[model samples]
Target: MTAAVTTEHREHYLALVGHGDEAAAVDYALGLAECGVSPRDLVLDLIGPTQRRIGDLWARDEWSVAQEHAATHVSEQVVAALAARHRPRPDRGVVVVACVDGEWHALPARLFAEVIRWDGWDVRFLGASVPGPHLVSYLHRHGPDVVAVSCSVPTRLTSAHRVIQAVQDVGVPVLAGGGGFGPGARWGTKLGADRVAADGRAALEVLRSWPLRAVAEVSPLRDSFVSDDEHVLVVKRGAQLVAVAMDRLADRFPAVHGYTAAQREATEYDLGQIVEFLCAGLFVDDVELFRAFVSWLCVVLASRRVPPETVDLVLDVYHDELFDFPRARAHLVAGRRQVPAGRQVAA
Candidate 1:
């Protein structure tokens, strides 16, 4: 029987995890298990939200990378504890859970594996960034009923598409999940996945209702975006783009000019991500892909007390640099519009 996950219980678990007390967090989870809180709810309700909060805290600068890593480590321990307590039923079908290549966020995929195992599926949880060829080799050897791919970062969508196709080539139906797939798994369908789940619970429901003899579709790789040479140009010039943007940033924002080594490196990383996402968006031929990232970038910068206009300035620099590339120019312009105007740093 599933126990009730009251707000009080949730808060207690979150507090323990946030404090980086792995033993305390595990004990708390075990106590809930003793009280009949189902393993599924334990993962989805308590651990899931706590991990998300950790990410949010990091984005807002409320937590350091070390703190975030420590908290995530605790969550993983909690999941292991739950897994030990719940034994799988042998009669259920086998399912393989993994993250797409280049996606280092493994907790969500781990949570899904635990939830599905609790629901009686024999889950093989391949943690973190399984390459396409390796995943295909596993499929040929194990022959699971379904393969669930988890991707958290939008920038890895291109990799996700490759993994999806590779799995289908081996005749395994693929279930795509996570934020990288876009709202409602719109990108998943475009990538030729058999199904898309919003979360673990939803994934379970979809699996339950899935046809027994579903044949994975073999679709040709979509090539409409390949003809756009602008993506290639931006990728080839990425380093130059970052360097020029940094030079222009120093002129526009005094804070950037006086940044410490660590701060300068962080800013450089941020600029690199912008270029990468732009190229990824171009590869997918979806402007919203880049636009959504810009919106999130604005929030992250605002949280760090930096002017959101920094994104606009970067985009402006790109516009001038890529002026001859029509598609790249248009996408940069669209991204610039998504960033709301904020206080400009005095130069």
Candidate 2:
């Protein structure tokens, strides 16, 4: 039987929020509405709080990618249904919401758009991965009153500055907000942004104030340590695109020289002097493998309760599979270090 949408629904909503369960969140919202919870209260108390919980869970690593997607989807549905139920307010102007190029995370933007819409402002959700030129064209054509740009990763911050320039060129005020701006309150200021909201609700409050002006002067792009080395492989994992430096791998793991020519030719591990490598899909690149291997070695060195079978398994499989593993292990043993037994080592 389906669970009744009662005060009990709040608990389920909380779970959906914490885990990013979209479908369950929608159902919870429906129940809350049936139980006579006003949309205004639902937005302020339920939806807002739920997003905060999702952020917390993400920080704690308690939620998976699937869970976060589910939560975001359900929250979107809730916003849509609520908007349909409420008559449009005539007072406020339109907002153009987007993420900067290379910044593909959009849940925060979507959530803020909904909250602003609920507060009587019209919103144009540009979704994720919007290019700067496209946004400039969009602003030129549509002429939204406010532009909201989000970037969760610090890596894409340089691209974000370009987005700000594009929007400002079209004479629209921009509201920049998200995880990236929280650490340094001066982040937006440094970027020459009009206003920086601490969060979604704070953004809404800033927009409502109306008197806040966006700076007109253009700013230079922020510094990026990410180099254009071809040996550098960039891989996207959710909102972050981690860059791996493979150029220094050989010096770090000189035992790689011990591999047979056949082994060297067959495995990607032998791409000598690799500057960058990506960690895309299921398989990890050589950089991540090395990092994981080192961390595993650390745990084995520290933990005493590891099983003998696990240690034997590591010696049998990894020692044979990796050309450098045997030499590395020998080095560790020579240092009088004891390795722990384990099935899978944490990285």
Candidate 3:
């Protein structure tokens, strides 16, 4: 294809996203394939940007659940049709895409398959929620050049880690991706995975030239806004949580002490453990008091310069006590007094 034709085809793909026209996107991808456009080019030039836009639309609330589902279905059809025309290349190395046991989000994995296919790889996509035994059996059977796992929820991390360990046991390298591996996202390294890709394009680039032999120098997964996990802090409001790594939370809580250390241990359930301890001082089942206590932990104990051992002591004391609303409310009030009156509440 001429440069102009390729560019025009790519633009058509982008236009589909701009208009939220999944059908148009499908037609464009098919048109590129029929016109003898390289699958790699189609993926690198078209599908990557298109999927990013789709994610952005969802993020911005510009696309409803139905619309997002429709878009994903359309993209899947397009990739399936294209794959039917091109068989996996023998020399491009083996790749398998699977979702962790509990994550139903397969669009990311689908887009990635299209990407590796475009890169001339031999890809076997296991779709959403393939169990650990199946994954192990498949890895033992195929011994792919790389294994790419998608996990979209933090709740699924335990399962995802299990999958990674299972795959690694067979000597397969695993690359962990998806929204779950965000800034301050924990357990990626502890799960013993090889690498984590922050975005789709970055993932494709890394896998293409990745070494067959493992690189002994393992490092933390880099995030969009933060590269270092030690600097990220996670804030939990009861069951809801948000994580900010790389000193971003520091700017948000200027008056809070020990922000650095708090950032270091801010993993999922870690805050919950802290909350349980702090709640001991408060009344149980009191939502308002609990929220206030969480806020206090974030701003006071978490923000200030409390020693890690001291903070651990506080959490140890309150890990499990009956609801004491009046006492908890009093502690909340005292905590609030330490901060400026008009600060924003923690999530």
Residue 151 lDDT, candidate 3, scale 0-100 = 81
Estimate the overall C-alpha local distance difference test score of candidate 3.
0.58
Worst 10 residues of 2 by lDDT: 273-282
Cα lDDT tens digits, model 3, 158-249, are 57767887777677788888765543223454455687776667777778768846644343432221122211111123443212211333
RMSD of each: 3.3, 11.2, 13.3
Q: Per-residue lDDT tens digits of candidate 2, residues 133-236? A: 88888888898887888877544555766787767777787778876543433456556677788766677677887653444432343222232322122222
Cα-based TM-score, every candidate = 0.91, 0.58, 0.56
Highest lDDT among the candidates is held by which one? 1
52-140, model 1: which lDDT tens digit per residue? Answer: 87888888888888989988999999999989978877567888999999999999999999898888888899999999999999999
Q: What's the candidate order when arranged by decreasing TM-score?
A: 1, 2, 3
Model 2 residue 86 CA deviation (Å) reads 2.7
What does the lDDT come to for candidate 2?
0.56
Model 3, TM vs. native:
0.56
